[model samples]
Target: MAFRSFGSVDLSPSECYDMLVNVVTPRPIALVSTVSADGMQNLAPFSYFQLGGTSPPSLMISPTLSPEGTEKDTLVNVSATREFVVNIVTREMVEEMNITSVRVGPTEDEWKLACFTPIASDIVRPPRVAESPVHLECTVFKIIRHGDGPSASNYVIGEVVRFHVDDAMLEGQMMLAEKLHTVGRLGGDNYIDTGVPERFRLARPSTPLSRQ
Candidate 1:
């Protein structure tokens, strides 16, 4: 099989990003919202998002610096206020979510452009996306920066303080994946739906017994 060694290829930052996004398969999208110190609200989608773990219900969203080497409003707001909300995007809300991905001035509001209703979060200053099926109100645990250019990343680590799930998508404590229909980010303009056709569950194996 043909293989491309990233280190040996000497790819540009954009090329590396393209390859990483394409090779990562489907990644969960985080529609993160934050409030500036002056109360300006910011919302944007980050595909480089992952769950830290369930023990403390943490989440990490890696936001890159803008082309001008400036921090994105989401990261700036998060740094100032140390709070944000992560709204899960569903298939039905893909269009609206995409609207928020547009690059706008730091003072501009994506909620207005996206036409998504912003509901007040219980503990966080940033509002949650009302159209999203799930919202996680989080407090910034830390911000770890990597690299030193426009392509550099700021890892926003947030601890989920409160979780809100739509009633129709929940059965007791379990969230129905089909009902949620969450959209995942693929390479470029591609996206995937979290439906039964693309989902499967595997039981974890128990630890091996010790040999006598």
Candidate 2:
């Protein structure tokens, strides 16, 4: 089999981004909510997200700079307030979540645009998306900037202070994946639905193969 390789240095920012989003394969979406210093709400979705750590309960979401070198409202809000809420995106909320991603002014409220019910967060100024089953109330731990200009990422490391879980989605201490109906991002105009039929479990090996 022949595989083509492209040099990173030769690719433009947009080309690199296109290659990345196409190859990453179903990245989990973080529907992040934040509030400006003036108390204006901002909501946005970022697929460049992941669990940073388990012990401290941290999440990392990377928001990239626009083509015109402008910062996103979510980044600006979180930077000023150092607080945000990460709402997990499920299949049912996908359409509304996408609506929140539309480019808008700093003062525009995405919660109203998406028609999502926002519940007052107990710890953070940003409200929790009532439509989401899991909400993580977080305070910014650190902000790491990579590169400069368009498509540059600002990695926001958030330490979760509180968690809001839908009681109905829980089975004792565990929240089953089947109940969540989580959706993930693929390439352009594509999304992955994590249905039970598409899932399988594999047990981990007790010892390394090299040791055996």
**For each candidate, what is the lDDT?**
0.84, 0.86
- Quote the lDDT for 48 in model 2: 96
**Error of model 2, residue 166, in angstroms:** 0.9
Q: What is the TM-score of each candidate against the true structure?
A: 0.89, 0.90
Pairs that collide in candidate 2 are none
Separately for all candidates shown, the number of backbone clashes (residues 3 or more apart, or on different chains) is 0, 0
lDDT of 2 by residue, 1-212 (tens): 99988899999877898999989977899999999999998899999999977889998999888877778889899999999999999878888888887777876677987899999999889999999999999999999999899889999999999988899888887887678888878777677778632432222222212210
The list of candidate 1 runs beyond 4 A from truth reads 196-212
| lDDT for 190 (candidate 1) | 70
Residue 146 lDDT in candidate 1:
96
lDDT (Cα) of model 1: 0.84
Model 2 alpha-carbon miss at residue 153, Å: 0.7
Off by over 4 Å in 2: 196-212
